[model samples]
Target: MEYIGSRVINASRATIANILADIRRLPEWNPAILSVTAIDPRVLVGKPYSIRAKLPGSPTIIYEQVSTDYVVWHLDGLQAHETGAWKLVSLADQKTEVTHTITHSGAIFRMLAGAFRTVPGLRLDRLQRRAEFGQERAGREN
Candidate 1:
């Protein structure tokens, strides 16, 4: 099964992508992510990061930035056949459009894909508020 989502945030592509791609800051914006530990603490292509996230039977994540516009990764111990992608597009006036896509072949994941589809959207919502307004809006949210 595949789940995809998109959102527009009022920030430069570099700023938004920088934050999203940085493993160290992931848990700061994404609640599901409990922690992220990358060997180099940088998002290089084909880097495997140890992520302690709130997912099923997974504490490590394999990360790879396929391109400046796309990223692919899979939850370790979840299923080799399952993977996810993030697409970032720069828009005019300091705005960026981000699209998230996840493909899970597991039977349990496929059955729950509908509910999981909203996870990215919710993550993006928090990201948008933070990236656009920073702590002022984010502080209020918390």
Candidate 2:
């Protein structure tokens, strides 16, 4: 199954891309992520990282692609295979339109598709708040 979400953030495309590419900061922007561990601060392609999330189990996540405009990562855990991609489009007035796409295939995800459908949108909302305001302000707003 695939789920997609987008938001217009009042930040540069580079800023949004940098935020997404920084693996150590996942918990700051992604509401589902409770913590990240044993990972480099800078996300490198093909490097695997672990994240503890609100979900039932921790997932091993690997970045397949990373760039200033986009990033793609894959997650394996809970008997599921999932891929996530983030694309940034620069807009006027130093703004960026960020599109986040998630695709997962497995018996577990198939059964829990409805429950996980809103994950991308929620993450994007937090990301927008984080990118626009500082982390401290974003936390208070949330």
Candidate 3:
């Protein structure tokens, strides 16, 4: 099964991508994320990190597919599963469109994943708020 979502943000792709691509800010934006541990902010791709999340119960999910376009997340339920990238497409007028997708198989896995179908939507809301408020460029006032 595959799940996908998109959001139009009122910020430059550079700002949004820099924020999303920067792993250090994950927990600050996503409520479901409890903590992101042991990651090097300087390293942006092709590395694994453990993220503990608050989805009824705290579970540490692994980020295995860290790439420029197709990131993936692995979750263990009755079995293991996956979720994917933060794809950012630039638009005119200082806006950008963001999408997140996931692919997994198994009845229970899909069912549980369905519950999080709104995650990308919620994450987008948080991203827009942060970007609109200039939180992405924090402490860099020139």
lDDT of 1: 0.69
Against the true structure, candidate 1 reaches a TM-score of 0.76
Please give the RMSD to the true structure for each candidate, in Å: 4.4, 3.8, 3.5
Order of candidates by TM-score, top first? Answer: 2, 1, 3
Worst-scoring 10-residue span by lDDT in model 2:
132-141
Segments in model 3 whose C-alpha atoms lie over 4 Å from true places: 55-80, 105-108, 111-113, 137-142
lDDT of 3 by residue, 1-142 (tens): 6667788877776777666656667777777666776557733444555666543333445566454344455654334355656777777656877787766665556557667667677877887888767655564444
The model with the greatest TM-score is: 2
Considering only N, C-alpha and C atoms within 3 Å, which residue pairs clash in candidate 1?
none
Per-residue CA lDDT of model 2 for 7-69, tens digit only, reads 888887767777888788878887767787854768888978888865566678888988868
**Candidate 3 clash pair list:** none
lDDT per residue (tens digit) for residues 1-142 in model 1: 6777898877766666666666777787777679777655557666667777655665566676655477677665463245767787888867778888777676556556576777778777877876888853355469
Q: How many clashing pairs per prediction, in order?
A: 0, 0, 0
Question: Candidate 1: misplaced stretches above 4 Å?
Answer: 79-82, 135-142
Better of 1 and 2 by lDDT: 2
